[model samples]
Target: MVTTSTSVRSKSCLGPPSDMSPCGNWKVSIVTSDLPNAGTSSQIYIILYGQHRSSAPIYLYGTDRAPFQDGHEDIFTITVGDIGTLFKIRIGHTNSGLSPSWCCKEIQLWNMNSGKQFYIPVQRWMARDQEDGEICREFPILNKGQPILPVTVYEVHVATGELWNSGTVANVYISIYGEKGDTGSRQLFRSKNSFNFLRGQTDTFFLEAVHLGDLYKIIVGHDGLGPGNGWFLDDIVIRDPTTNREYAFFCHRWLDQEEDDGKIVRELYARDNSIIFARQKLEHNRKETWAAESWKFMKGNTLQFYNRLTGGFVRLHPDGTIDATGEKMDKYGFFDVIVSKGNICIFQSHEIRHLSLALDNGCVTGMASGRASTELRVVYQPNRCALLESVLVPGHTVIFDRHGKIASESAAGYADLSKEFVVFVKGMFLNNAVILLATSLCQALCLQPDGSCTGVGNQSEKSYWRVHKISSGICMFESVKNARMYLRIKDGQCDGTGTGDIDCHFKIKKNLENASVSLESTKSPGLFVGLQADGQAKPVIYTKNGNVFFYPRVIKCWHRVALLHNKMGMPSVSGALKRNR
Candidate 1:
């Protein structure tokens, strides 16, 4: 714990010691009193020892006065390294004609430990209230030690009677304090006549070579008053030296309402470790312009364009062609399409139903068939592909063709028929899991652990059905009855449940030339499928579960093929068929 004590003294000068001779040093003195006139000026001098041997004597004084006014006294303080040096003090007129009647009250000397030594013949002075001012014989001395650390000083004025000035300057008076770790001594660094002229609201006074173990205390008194009130005294601060880092604190204020009487205060932290404070002001209106011009591209016209940012996923028009430089649709989605005939179309992830396309404009108007349910008259356009009315049916399949036809259809039994094409069963299997088969003509066959194949030639065998492992697992079978396609389980495997019941998945081999397949199961289940392909895995149409499917790469012209089936129809083939043919 740290402690401090303040002693106020009234003195005229620090007199010389009785037995000691005056060495070559200087001394300073300060006196406080109330003056009679407002514009009166007084002169005080700091006497110097060995004045006859040295050059001209330098004199200084100390006082607390209103910085802006002319009548108040002036105060000065001088610092010296050696205490053995001697000094003297006296009072004289700056300009003889302008000198005011001044009085010298008492004389005292302050030592390194705040000890006081007095001079005889104590002087007296008239106080500000016209009363006899007491001559204090004691002076306080502040000691400077070692272990020098950083310091902060806050100077505050105590309000005695009423509030003072009312402008920004009146709020400048602040209290000074030190954090726990500063070891240097705090003393009167300077006593300027105009404290208001200081540049900042807070000023930093520095001391070097502070001793390692000593408590630092801040002495606060009246610096200089504003225009309204004179000088006064308040409180002081003493803090122990610490080794911790220092951070800054700030406060902000704003008016609460229309009246000035109400205000709000907020505190904010710095964004970065080093940044302390920042302020910004924004305007109400600012114009923003996009660089690219809006091209007058038609709705059905397909053009190709690339986004400079993301390089994936090319956009296509409703007519199954790439759309570039197209006008943005009604701010809802992009381009608007109108249906010409009572056809089917798929938009986004849903399918439309009863879909009748307008012959002139290609606007689709009809009731949409949802997943497992149906809805009222929904309007859509083949060009825009926007669903004007949609009633969502959870977990049900909704299909839409490119011609604007929408319907809800069952995907269970059709899974067999879907094997002939690249089937995309949106809502068939568990979410995030879908089964795509190359062909339905390739019969679905199961392999036993004994390396035996069953259900090879039978299409209506009940045992050749696709069975899932407890609703969460999907069973995938390769339909290449006589061709070899490399099969490898990328993740999850089937268990040895010959019932083909397992809670895992498998994958086809990446390179078909090896004629070797690998299997991994989520629960390690047995899987069986026929393999029949030449050294080169060329695309071909095969039968699986009595359905016909073809791998598009088998044909040189068609590079890829995908079969899509939803509730409405085969909308997946709409765009691809238009492109390939």
Candidate 2:
């Protein structure tokens, strides 16, 4: 977690504080807004209150008050000792000062020991009902621990083809292999030999693997068939649900029978893996500017907009209002799943989970959240899950479904990844993940299993990947197929064989507006991750000249599409696996 304490000094007061001593082991800093109503030279004393009613409240600043500037937000931080666990703050103008009132825009507190700062904003302070003049509001509960992001699992499907059941054996068993093993290939589809059965329909069999490259070869074996004991097959089909790529094999005869006047041992062949997904990297500074504070997504960032409710999102509509109707994205439709402060934020990602945009009104309002809710059923629609804020819990933990009306009746909600990229990478310290794209020569970039790297792509099993995580949604590609090589830029392209391999590490910053990501090579300084017009999945050649800021290799990054079918994993050895194909 990046914090400001390391970079900016705490308690940067030009004038001396009225009180000379520090109170607790923590520090509190308050910054005022620069609006017109903001008091420029107002005098106000900050007081901290303890949980016990009998305990006297401590004045944050001694008798001397904090001076505020009219047009600029002012900063006032205090160091305190062990205050009670439960606390609140009271802001009041000096009794004798010229009645120029002040508004507290934002306040930040620092844990002196840990150097971690927490923030709070005061919209419009109100006075106490009692005779005493005091404006106060309790601080929000602090969020603790690292946030958890969503995890996505892709699907791999294999369908059987037409085969002539000429032999006596009616069923055949098929096993797939990326690399050969002594105990035969790993069986993905074990056949049931029933004569002339399952000849016409596409018998779909889902397979799972740690690496997709592990599936390159398929072996067809028969339990009992006469001489020439093989089945005359038509063709086999293989598809990746996530990447949306399909590999088709045209097998016209049995394993031994002639098919182009030769044998047909290979039942399936997919030739498109060589073709790399050519998405150009994005260029930020030239095209646009990003404010880090505004970009930093925090909880309680609410958006009251328009739209028709879908499963977990809203469709653009002319009529819109603030009502809890369905799920909506953060401000934009970018992040699918994000974790912040031990909370999980899930959005209705473009990639469909179970989309049904029917019978929904257009107007609705709701707060954006990164916290997951307790399980509940949809009141209006009992079949679906819910994500409403829990009224029962004082902390307001979120319920399972966004559209769910009743809190106690929905299924438990979980986070799902929205955008995904197939990448090859390895970790770099603060620089982030290193990529494994092609070099000027166009060879595949890779990381050797021995902690080294190469710039060649022929090692299919070692060079492919599916990247889903990054600090700012700007993820780098790593070779899961290869020995886990991270991609980087050497000169213009990354050379896995470079002297300081870490130098090739790059930070991909996503442009949520255009739905694109730009790669800034940390080593090359200003140079971005560029692509050669003719270089699709070939040798990476040359980058034109001195770092062109505007021309820093900009290309459209990822495309949002519905994953027709996913959820690929190891098949269980239970009754579910034994069901008829």
Candidate 3:
């Protein structure tokens, strides 16, 4: 936690005492420390209370046009004309803390005449947002000493699951806190500008340079207010520059200053860096890949290599190709991700086998290729939930997963670049096969067993419902508040139930004309589900399905959307991306 300040004058301590010396008029050359990532340019000025022999000390401010930045530059040369001894000199800012305040880690004062230099170490205080109660975070700065692991802030993700409609801020900025020498802690780095964010979207934040093992506080905040202002955070990915080791920090909830339930900031422990998928590649040797109804194209920023020869999208596929025509089951696409030791494997539930191909021989023959290894180098993406995995091929390279893999701009792939903002940040890997949520028309409010959104005894937390797609247009609503319960059709009546039996499955038919969804009971076919104006859902017929208009909304993450496919069309549940919001 950042400590409160006490000094009325912006206080600071100086190093190496020096006696008052006089040659000509003492020339004070002050050099300010440069922090390039420390937000916008700030007008830094030193104030000196000039004391006369008798009268009250006069104040003088100094700083020429040259602003303070990440370099050694003479901010000003004060002409403290020969006098007994001027009062104390302190640093202050022209603008408030909203902007990056002027800060110097090390300040060198040179007496031009005597060529004597005095150095002062001032850590932190780059921008004091806490004083204004800005949404900030306080954590420790890790890895201070030699074998320091240079870690990087990869990206920020938020689960816009139902309740969090936080369009909270137009832009959010980040700052890093670190300790310097004897100085307790200060702002080590600040984002140059605010990053654009949407309430339930994954925003790629300004990459922050950091250290591992040491506690470092990161403050992600916005200076705006009003509708769509509550920010919910999902997770953050930190990467080791040297080994490309990624640590995933999963925070699945609301993070708002106004939140009474809880704060949005979290200190996520870094997972082992052993699972690195960055330099590896998951190659698909299967032909007619997309022909599998389970296979759909994922959206994101990774290269998707198409084997035009077989019209198959490489990356994720079943052990062997099969038609998904007669199954009313979870789309055979999503792979139940299994993390093993330092490696990972994709378990194909439908195939009842792990996805494997292109072994030591780099060929697609089950005969000669001994047995495909389940071991793979799981390189995590910036968001950390997804992987850019590669098979355990001796010297081969390339990586992939869901959150679609559009080739890097250069098309040279991972080898041609170090860092870049690809397509989508994170996604649910349907066995790397591109699985989508099978239900839609968008949004549903959770209903307590009594048809009340307010939980038993009026608990608010039990109100939101999370829709999990099971099959074609069929979904099960899980309680956002009560994990044990799910929206179900009990004895042909609408109610909340604990078990996910066939009665809980509802066929979500899209009424495009009405711009809503139709939930026809899968078990008791003729009856429909309806929601009352008071927000209660009940079993009803097509005529009374009026209030069934409680459309479930889909959440998407976006820093900026670059839709490669420009045209819009009706989305069908036959094959689509899984709904995880």
Candidate 4:
């Protein structure tokens, strides 16, 4: 119990009275501003021993002055003490008999008891979102493509899951289904809390999974009693543990701006004038334009479009002339174009070729003989020779001659006796030189130095060589090595007259040997020359329709010759000489 005391003193000290206990404990004195009046009475009140009725009370004692109120002037000693076992103090009130109202200026309670004070500190409570704090939500899936681990899931509502009501759902229960023909049923997770309708309280559910397939579908449903019991899904996030990066598939919706809406509305501008305007603007602003395909710099300052599939350059210029310097451009399978100084150059295989305008020069001049040459040629020939003219086209086969005249000259056609044209000559003939010439029917003709020609008559039909005229008297003839000749003679008398009759004859010259002979096939019908080699003998004469007798040993001391020809019909000796060099 708690106690208090009050006391008052006068300006003058009063003498102590003798009416006190032997201990000399107290001499109560009262001090008043005036003498006691008959209508007003002053009393001194003291609390000797007291107990608090309901609570501890404080006692006050003071001297009362004249102008003071009824309870202000009388001097008294006040002390508070607890009498009862309970820790408390009480105040006393008394009525006076001398006056209509009794006034006690000072009051005191003597002998006060003390009590122990007890107190408790006040406490406050508040709540906040988990994410709003330092804590973050745990990602569910782990090693999605690998083996799965045991999983624990918790359900949460989207509205309350986020600290800011980000309207996001975290770890919410989701039902997933497998693809078609799946043998297993869909799996489900549940929420941890339920909503209260009366208090309008709501709860969120959190879901977790150990592993997810490459493809899966999720189904959501509501279990609450609210009108809209559907799942509240907002921002769904995925996180990779290895990288610790969070990814979201959803983005916040934004209002469409007027410019964006106009662009959308004009999406079909590609077919309208707006697209043309946009393209013009884009081109004007663009620094450069890229070529669609590879190109090469051809002759006459022209860019050639290279065709990768064909391994050729498409001539962009009208003339389609590929320059000799840029011929290496064909090596590249693809190429691009570069512009410099307002001129186009093709960049291919790390090489650059400047383009130039194509000239209308009729033909490419100064081309070496027997090499490929192209020129523009105007063909003018007789109607009979027009067959050759029709075969040539400008920029391809028909080209201007060395005289700068457009000529219809080609080495490929048959020789024409009536016209002159530039011919792509591959071979030439020299005077007094022996050369093998093949006829239109592929028969080989051996032209002699004397302008006379001899051949095995139509070997394709097995026709043997029948000499019609041999110089009158014995004329010396040398047989070529590895060459054979067959001759048939006509019956004739000593008078230089002959009866026309022929027979088959064949002969072969032995290898590595040359033979000489002076003979005439028209001399006798039975004239036969048999040259034998390699154990094989050939009869020089055989009766075709009739036969007559002739001297058998007239051609003594003469041997046949054998000739070996190569694929080109040139003598094997010539081919061996060429290879030896």
Query: CA lDDT of each candidate?
Result: 0.25, 0.34, 0.38, 0.24
Better model by lDDT: candidate 3 vs candidate 4: 3
Once model 3 is optimally superposed onto the true structure by TM-score, how far is the C-alpha of residue 100 displaced, in angstroms? 10
**Per-model RMSD to reference:** 30.2, 34.9, 18.0, 48.3
- For candidate 1, the 10 contiguous residues with the lowest summed lDDT are 284-293
Kindly list the per-residue Cα lDDT of model 1 for residues 1-581, writing each as its tens digit.
Answer: 10121222223223443312322222233343333442224433332221122122233422334211123323333332233422232233232224343444443344333344324222333222222221111111222422122222222212121011111222222222232222112233322233431211232332221222323233222223343222211111222234332223322121122113342222222121123322211010000000000111221212222221121112333343321222222111132222212222222211221222221112222223222122212232211111222233222222323222222233233321110001111122222221222221222233333333332222232122232323433334322321222122322321123333233244332212111223223343333232332011111223242111111111011111222233346455446568798
lDDT of 2: 0.34
The sequence of per-residue lDDT tens digits that candidate 4 reaches over residues 385-501 is 111111122233322323223334463232321222211111111111122222111222232333222331121223212232222322212222112332233232111111222
Off by over 4 Å in 4: 1-361, 367-439, 443-456, 459-581
Ranking by lDDT: 3, 2, 1, 4
TM-score of each: 0.19, 0.21, 0.32, 0.15
Which of 1 and 4 is the better model by TM-score?
1
lDDT of 2 by residue, 360-456 (tens): 2211223233222311111111111122223223323322234422122224344321111111111211122222232311233345555444432
- Which consecutive 10 residues in model 2 have the weakest lDDT in total? 546-555
Off by over 4 Å in 3: 1-107, 110-167, 177-195, 207-217, 240-247, 257-581
Best by lDDT, which number?
Answer: 3
Model 2, residue 156: C-alpha shift (Å): 26
Which predicted model would earn the best TM-score? 3
